[model samples]
Target: MGGRILVADSVATNRIALAAILKRGRYNVSMCSTASDALQMARAAPPDLVFSASELPDMPGTRLTERLKAQTGMRDVPVLLMSRDREAGDVVSALAAGAEDVMPQPFNELALMARTRSLMRARETDRALEQHQSTVRCLGFSEQAPDFAPAARIALVAESRARGIALAAQLKREISQPVATLDLTGALAEADSAAPPDVYVIDATLEAPGDGLRLLADLRSRPGTRHAAIVIITDADNSMAVANALDLGANDLLLVGFQPQELALRLKNQLARKRRADLLRASVEDSMRLAVIDPLTGLYNRRYAYAHIAQIDELARKTGRQYAVMLADIDRFKAINDTWGHAAGDAVLAEVAKRLRDNLRGIDMVARIGGEEFLMALPKTSDIDARMAAERLCALIARDPVRLPGSDQSTAVTISIGLAMSGAKGRLSLPVNTLIDKADRALYCAKAEGRNQVTVSRTAA
Candidate 1:
């Protein structure tokens, strides 16, 4: 079975009809006669999605959807409203009230199942992102407030420039934002730009038949534009176009000519969705960063250092360039730890990290891989420049005294650097781990020769 589904309707025949269609698709279908029963059954064992008629004996499907969303755990479950032919206004209201979609009966099987699969796929994605729910909540991203009057970027693609301009002007009165009229030639290029549209409104009858649908596919193919909201506008009688558009990755659709107020409402809903997805993406990125970054010193951690070294090695191999690796260890770090508390030792580490990070080029990466030890990668650097950089870092640490947070005392510190380079000629065949090992060996050699100095590995020269 694809997923569990609950069908809620007042009439038995109506319930059975929808259930049979879902069952044909191998979904686990559960039937309920009233909205009250539907809620109880859903709370007992929540289904992946719900198909409820617009009117029930006790309540409307919109009310049922609202009730389900009220619960903390069931908020993500999708609800599709089934509206009779006479209920066009109700269908619009239901969608605005938060139903995933409203299908007018007799439902088009393709659109229904396509919508089902789409919603289910979204549900699964949300479920996966829930793994970071705790961290997202800690960052205050879990609770997002909707903007009352939405201002968003809109992309309008129509058959003619006049119709597109007219639509843009009509929309501009209701909401304040840039509504770009796009031709097919400039569509993909604009999508690649830094600020792509927030919502794309494309006319179904374009310069030629099916061009609008083709454009939707093109937009989704690009990584940067895939997440942008797409709304299709088509003629009233072309029911098949609506279905095709939905199945072809259009996020929302409207039939007939333009109405400004309804257009505003639909665009606002899309903007809200776009903002929410952006927030979730950002939260996941933050968690991923936290995993590989040292919270105290704000430097890359050991795990990131190892992976980064490999990436640099691959890039060097492809480009026929040399990369430098350096291991830095603070001299007599234990004495500082013993003389002052761990907090002062932490202060010293932070100071050293700042100096090393600020002095280097953007192409360099530095990580704290051990207690009082740091590792660095400098890509495409010559042996002389690498040695000069290592010596400069040593001097920066010894130049200043790191002050304690509370006490009026200061601690002086210096670092010893061990330098190794992937020989500029045969760097492609060299293993990154060997470079790291060579750097470690030279780091120890520097400590032996005396603390607070720099040493270069023999293999590097």
Candidate 2:
């Protein structure tokens, strides 16, 4: 079926014209002569796109837009405004009132078609996004959480056959998805063809040879099922079952013998809590990601680099070991910006940052401190190791020519690096800033000697 469209206009002629155009395009069209009628139709069943005239018989188009947006389910629907006035302020006002697009009087066929197509595409995209988000939220993964694809299979484990049947009924009634229930004693191995349940609920009691607790323990031990959210249903109010369940890695515990409302509430609450935990985890990951990441180049930022160095320094002091820091700078970066463009300069910086990150070990931290400057913290590394790492990074960057995006042109980017180490058994007392300064001084010496080389900081006497 073609896309659905709602066309609202005060004049019958304009409505007829738009309906004809939409019909020619094989779209399902609904016509309303007033804002009130349009709103009624929209509430009855939302359309893919709404086109309303600026002046409606009952209310202004802007007011209608606001009202439509205020209503649940209709807020995300796109509203396009049509006006006879060509004034910029009028267009701006309509947009501010939540109209996704506006077309002045004497709408050209081409412009109308283009605007209609764009708004429809945007609305479809938004619909897909909302549906995906809803699925994620249902499964206890919020927008902030890591990417969790929708589950194709669902599993429920209950000891009582009657209770299992009832729970399955409730799931089917509450959620518009397929769900399968299994006796806690049933072998999970049997469900190998079906994808593992994204969520697993285990009843505390089992009619099987062994109790459900054993099954829960067995599932927890299996590496494949370790990440699944496990909800344990129990009648046991004592601390032992709860503690044991938690110790066995159950994500939640649901008490049985409650009213249906209570059971549903508990289920919903557990799901929400799981989603919240996932969101928090994602937030922490994103924070950690940003902590070391330079926004422009996607490299680690200075704060993380400093913290990494501090950690290494502490470890080295305790173990009578040594580590090194490398400070690097781009030579004549300003000249490139002046001659080519800030875009070209940015390209060069990004390339350099990529090279630095690529050359470092996974445990090593590479951070961009400022414009054209970077720092690397290497743990369990000596001065010589640091020098070698820096030299390797410099050589790699110097060898590669950075090709600017959207352009055929390539530019040479070179880096000068400085290395410094904390002496072993001397208990390096230098602060993070001091260590960076020592590395920076060496970097300056390298730059002075000649660009694109690595220099070591003078060893402490």
Candidate 3:
């Protein structure tokens, strides 16, 4: 099914007709006679979209939409209302009452289907984002509360400078953000700037044939502006141009002589959609950031360590040089937790992590593999250099005390390190786990001998 659609009309013929039209488009459709019945059917199983008659037998379609929107899960589903009678002020009232779109009588099938496809595309994108947000929340990560308003860029493009300026002036009265006019020749150059427009208003009736269409197609192909919202405005009755604009990825179509209020409302909707998309992109980036790093210690976690080690391993094999792997454990970490509380233990761990990171060369990587345990990797390194690096790490930690939160007192902590060297001569003779296991054993020996020291795996010798 392309999508699930519910049709609500009091007349049986209206219900059947709408359902047939949607069914032919391969939509999974359900029909209902009244607003009450529509609400019941929707609650039973939510649909992707709802089409309702403007006036129901018992209630208006606007009331039905309000009822559906009041439902917790159905708010995101679009509501489209149809009216055979184009009465004065009816469309505005229906729109104000929460209809996603109000289609008047004698609807052109082509235009109607185009609107349906556009709405479905937008809904599908939102659904995917909602599912991703749920998964991120399930992992116990919360989005940082945003404080700033969106400053979406709006660009007006036309072959005529005067016409572009006129459009910009009208947009300025409606949009709170910056609005700028660009010539057809300068559209791509402006798009390539540091801050590209979020929404584009292109005049389809440019003096040069297909000038606007070419720019629209190029914007869709460009990486920087591919996601932008494109609205096409035609000054004349060019049905072919309107259809072609829709086919060429125009988000909205407008008549050039339309009222500025109508254009403002449409622009507002486009900007809202753009802002939602931006937020979804940001959310995914943030989730990816959380996946690899430890929240408390601010260090790469175990998974990241293993993945990076594989990259380092490949480099070492190509270079035919020895690399070092070190496992470090803090001495008496549990005792520190028990005596000074977990706060002091956390402070000590964070401080030690900073010391380990700061003392290492840019070529080295350090990660927190377990509680009080850290793993370090150095690619294209020798055993002697590894030893000196480990010694320097130990001195950095033992030489200073960590400042505990909410207290003036400093807590003392020390770490032990176990290092193993890779095979020489451009050969990765041992697997990564083998090297880790060898270092683990040496770490055990260091802890047994006495904490706050370094030990080399016998296998390395």
Candidate 4:
């Protein structure tokens, strides 16, 4: 099946006709003759899209839209209203009342199907974001609502500069946000300091027939504009162009040129949806960072290090390359904390982490696995190279003194390191815990020999 659609029309012929068209497109259709019934049905099980005629037995389609918008679950569902005639006021009113788009009868079957598909695609995107957000919330991390106003940025790209300017001027009257006019060159140009537009109104037949369509694909490929809402303006009779436009990632479309009020409503709807998605994406990134990052030292935490080591061990077994695991402990960290206080000890840990990261190769893994103990992994390393790296880490820490936060005084710091390898090439790599244990024993030997030095495991050699 294509998707689920709820169709509401008082007229039996109208309901049958619309349902038949949708059924041919493979959409699962549910029919209702009154607005109240439609609302009740939707409450029981929400549909992907809602299609209703302007006049119902109990309420107008706009009233239905308002009611649907009020419901928390159905707020994101797209409502398409059908009007008896293409009256500008009715279209504007319907859209302003929160209908996704208002179709004037008798609507072209091809255009209706294209719009349905586009709306369904958008609805699915919203549902996915919402589901992910719910999952994040279940993990005990909730996203804060965005503080900034929803002042969406708009870009108008037309066939000519004059047309773009004219459209921009008209759109400015309908919406309060900033609007800019751009040519094809400007539209596809590389990003700069200026923020990318939140919604782009692009002409489908710019200089040539398919030029705008090509531009749509290019914009989607670009990282900066890929998530922006794209609305295509094409001829009402251009069925093929409309189909291709929706297929190429156009979020919405405007046929029969721009009607300022209708266009404004569509732009606003798209902006709201885009902003919600952006919020969800940001929340996911923040949650992931919190899960794997050490707050004090700004290094990967023990959990992340353990998981990474498993991957590295698997790779070494396949390639038959030796890898190194090292456990380093700050010398007399408890003494520092006892003498200077916890703040100074924290400062030392942060500085030591920085030094270790700076001295190691980019591919090396450095993580703070304990209060003063750090874990480091180096792939494809020999025992001699591992010992040299460990020595370098020890020297780097002892060479400098870290200043206490909010204090002028500085204290010298040093770390003792123990290194172990995953055996020579052509041998199976040791288990992650086994390598870690060997490194730990070597570290004990280092502490016994001297406070600040490097030691290698005998078995590893």
Candidate 5:
């Protein structure tokens, strides 16, 4: 509501009307008559939102939207379409063409204001999410145990040493960070170094004993820096070089002879892209965590457990190795909730999940399948190993009392475990449900024998 809005239309009257409306609503409005002019204006000073008529003097509003979105920084700006045609099909087409919203002409002022407010709110939400995701990713990167300095690092591998050094200096000045430059001379010698820069800017003209493309491919293939962003700078605007760069996962292609200012701008654009990609990756990981993780305990939930078991079962069939499944349930867990309240129950579950994680091998999968039940899949493990692991887990829980925060009482808890193992032939081809059922039966047997014990299915032996 407080920021600038760009209103573009070929028709003077339409532009004036929209500008007046936006101005009356306390928005700073910029008016333009052509798509090309709108693009220039938007790029120079991007508005909070854009309202463009479908028919522009130079190009269609759809094309304008596409062009603006294709640009480095303006991709996320919201564009609304205003057209006189007003047909449902036209509105659909405009939206499909990248307009965030479409309003038919002969518009109602109230509806227009409402839609504008909604779009603005949506944009603000998206921007906040993007920022949060970026922060989370940067935090995650920083928190890695090895403490890699990815944020402050840059690498420039170039053919022309003088040009590369000059560009590296400019880049360091522009970004206010140090950059490391390497040429064909240093590629093989320093390839195994512990620290690789976050970004690799390669000169496409580098001709060493091996192929230049192969060098790019090798840099990308390495585990330490596989995820680093790559940029290819070429002397000629060769389509082949550009295509090869793209094929080898180069993030951008830049012409070598650009002005210093232009070079800085291009470097800034690539850095922005790198930041956005980090944000996107964090968002995806967060979404995945929400989908499959139990919020209370930081363990995988039932759905993910099922999926993991199915995959492991298939792998067992192919590899012909023994695999084990274990189902664990806290004994008399409902009484804990009833006696101490749900908060205490949650604390108990959290403690149990932590113990399970701490006790198991890194490759083992453990998940919460229900309120007080958990499922663990141990691959390449026999029945004896599974029973030994379960016994240790059960003994630990029985001996350790969970101390709830802000409470004076400590509640002792115990777990019953049921384990099932596939035969030496490795693959049971049994349905996930059937495998779970076997473990569930074993769990029942454990409870029947006595709580705080481990029981293995007879079939498993």
Candidate 6:
């Protein structure tokens, strides 16, 4: 994926080199020689990724990472630290300081490009999710709390049982999260589980060469584990495998074998990233549900009903099939609210919604379009069938009284329904709004003729 990257290095040659490589990969590259300049540039407009040398003129690269992360909009922008022959302690410190990874200098082109692609893809996804979440919050829904970090579940998969067990034990000691050891088959089985591992540490060459890469692809494809973070461990000499692992959706990689602390820190970062993604997905789902559903009666609202009617209309036009639309109103609903209070009216509305929803065919659509007013549609229905259905609905509501909130007493309730049909012989198809208006006129006829009855629209107009 193409993205903007900020490259900060004191050495002119190093900045040029990195920029050339990134530009070759189709990334827009910006450069700065000092940490202060990089900070200023980034604050003005955050890049998709940042590549900073561990040694900066004014401040250390890790400090730059810390500062960028502390910035409000820049927190999710990943930072990659370039280290030349850096010690293990330095790598650990950089990671702990929130750098995405510490890349070795005189970079391996294949590994560098693959890692860059991986980072860019993840950053793009994060940005899209954040944009959706922001839209949701703008619709008056609360955003998920950032500080909530649930305990992560980690899985250790190795070529051998002993190796897997040993690594699991080591990981258990380094982190407080639950750890489990699984072989290739066991890991595959996790794809069927409801709560699979939040992260999987897979040793390359499980049963044969590149087995772990296959597993990574499989886990990423499965719905249950598709969003789970995966880290692949490979030999330092196997740069091709490292590149392949990242290309196949491995979240991170471990070369020169795994150190418990380093793996733990990497796992922590992956877990936190996955949590943010999961919460954002949940928030989007909640917001979408709220947008289309009526909170009062737990039924679809006017907005959704209109869209659904359009769909039904289109389908009827294509298939030349008959469909029914009905406008239902609770008779004398205002008097109930005035006499017993809005609470009793709410109770009655809820009961009526439930009755309508339960009694209708599974393919039928029912929604509360307004207070004391509902919209129902039945596809592939005849006028005779529609009239019978409407009569049944009127009887269903008037058959028994609805019990009031927190009271033993009950009040009698009735509904008047107006029915209109599509696909009448020699008649042209009507627009959805026009059909609704016809149903409304029929409803007026029903209310005028009697309080509790069904009225079918006969005139084409």
Q: Which candidate should be chosen as best, given lDDT against the real structure?
A: 6
Residue 434 displacement in candidate 1 (angstroms) = 36
Clash statistics: count for each candidate: 0, 4, 1, 0, 0, 0
Please, what are the lDDT tens digits per residue for candidate 6 over residues 1-461?
Answer: 26679999999999999899889997879999999999899888678899999989899999999999998679999999998875778878989999988898989889999999999889867765665455456556645566857778899999899998888888888889999999999999977788899999999889998899999999999999999999999986778998999999999988755578899899999998999889888876676587967888888788767766776676567445678999999999999999999999999999999999999975687899989999999876788888999999999999999999899999999999988888563453677888888889999999999879988887522
Q: Please write out the lDDT profile of model 5 over residues 344-432, one tens digit for every residue.
A: 99999999999999999755888998899999998778777888898999999999799976788899999999998876773466676
> Per-residue lDDT of 349-441 in model 4, one digit per residue for the tens?
999999999888755778999899999999767788888889988988898788888988999998998888897657664788999999999
TM-score of each: 0.59, 0.41, 0.59, 0.62, 0.43, 0.64
Worst 10 residues of 2 by lDDT: 128-137
lDDT of each: 0.81, 0.70, 0.79, 0.84, 0.73, 0.86
Q: Regarding TM-score, does 3 or 4 come out ahead? A: 4
lDDT of candidate 2 over 278-312, digit per residue (tens): 45545534555534457799875665556556656
Q: How close is candidate 5 to the true structure, as a TM-score?
A: 0.43
Q: Residue 449 lDDT in model 6?
A: 96
Task: Return the TM-score for candidate 2, rounded to 2 decimals.
Answer: 0.41
297 Cα displacement, candidate 1 (Å): 24
The candidate that wins on TM-score is: 6
Per-residue lDDT of 193-307 in model 1, one digit per residue for the tens? Answer: 9878888998877879999999998898888789889998876456677767877888787766446766777787778767766667766556547676787788888876786
Cα lDDT of candidate 3 equals 0.79
Query: Which segments of candidate 4 are over 4 A away from where they belong?
Result: 190-194, 292-461
Candidate 2 structure lDDT: 0.70
Candidate 1: where is the Cα deviation over 4 Å? 86-88, 134-151, 235-240, 290-461
**Model 5 clash tally?**
0
